[model samples]
Target: MKILLLSFILLGLYGFCLGAGGGGVSSSTSSGGGSMKETEDTKRLREGRPLILTCEQNATNLETKWTKDGNELVAGDHIQLFPNTTLYISTAQKEDKGEYSCKTGSMTEPKIFHVVELTLQKHLPKSTTVLENDKLSLSCQVQGDPELTVQWLKDGEPVEDTDNSTRLEMSDNEYDVPNAVLSIKPIQKSDSGNYVCLISLYSINVNTTTVVRVKDIYAALWPFLGIVAEVVILCLIIFIYEKRRIKANFDDSDSDPAQDVKNNVDGKKENDIRQRKH
Candidate 1:
């Protein structure tokens, strides 16, 4: 009778332990959320990265459930729930930014997962019309990680910015977002193409394109017109010099004709007198 009572007591204790929630929290393991280089109780991931969260419990008949921000996690294209109590996130997004918890018949500490949001926000013009030699300004509004870099491209190729000209500027706005500007003092016809603002961070790149339509009036004929004006000025100077030289020669010739005739008559008279004397 004592043995039977002891068996009942032990069975009751086992049932009581099962009714209460204690074994699952202690036996469950939180692992597999980062890369091989990093492992921690919680994970900090950037957007588009992949991660896995595994759970292990001591209960045999228990089923594991995953929750995000106190809401039940659903299996979707980007999220997969495995039978081995694993939750996989294929491509992390900003929406996935919250605390993640594994529920195995008990509520436990949630692992905070930080997802770094990446974005390229810009106000781009489809087509801009400006007169030739006018100032051109192309701006892009960008909001993302500060580590993100900005690049300028023209006509599907990279722009050469080796000079680091003052035409390009990067400033922070009120919210500390990057505001990039590419300004040209005298907009040329060559600058009238598709200008691209490329923003990149990690392996993701986003760009916006704009076209500049420059109205150049007689642009090709300008050099020829300048050459014609120079030639015309040179010819005018030469013509004036030639006319002054001809006038001077004509004035010198007019004073000589009458004097030469008188001198010739006097010389002949003098010659006849000398001949008579001889």
Candidate 2:
């Protein structure tokens, strides 16, 4: 019975130790988190601004590593690892755009960052009406850090001007950064449509539209100005006819009046002669 009791005690102790060991292993396994896929997160940041990307963990102690796309990141003066888990970009630039992630044990979903330096908009001469045969000049302005690849479009198609092209001329002027000018020399009615100034930088595309309404030089005359001209010509003809008629009346009427005056004068003279002879 003593031997049996001792054997029973040993068996119980072994079972208890085994249970404790299994519990310890389970705890350790849970402490290391499994990799999880996340939805895409995208960010648009202004160039030259600071940004932070973080990787939070459920574990108390974690060793974190950073990667961009799939390459292990090498921290530089412009980029640094903060708190050993968070990424700090000193100044976001166009070259900084990439998919970035941090790995505690497994990579978190990548955060996409895109940096834009400029925003372009129509600057001068609001939607305008220009007379036909007049030169059309348009300006497009940009704000923020402007790095631009510019193209001018008429209606909906790209505008390409050659040396021999008579109607369109394009030039870029850089007062501070630069603005584009489209010169439509002697703009025609066909030139009337939406003129868009397209500016693109990196992955950002911006455009400004200016509607041009080309007016015929005689557009205002529509129906009224022509009518006025016809009335003037008719009035001039009537005035000339009336003046000629008055002149004819003067010549005919003056002959009768003159003859009557002369006859009266002759009769008076005859009377005087007769009196003297008597």
Q: Pick the candidate with the highest lDDT.
A: 2
Each candidate: how many clashes?
Answer: 0, 0
lDDT of 2 at 89: 87
Query: Where is the poorest 10-residue window by lDDT in model 2?
Result: 24-33
Cα-based lDDT for every prediction: 0.60, 0.61
TM-scores of the models, in the given order? 0.37, 0.45
Which residue pairs show collisions in model 2? none
Deviation of model 1 at 200, angstroms: 0.8
For model 2, what is the alpha-carbon lDDT of residue 131?
72
Off by over 4 Å in 2: 1-114, 121-126, 143-146, 161-166, 174-179, 220-278
lDDT of 2 by residue, 1-278 (tens): 34654555565555545433322111111111112222224344557888766676333455667777678887789888765466788788777766676667655554343333454433444465677777777766654343457677877787664332477877764434344777878777788777777766545565666677776666544444444554566567668888999999988877777889899999999999999999
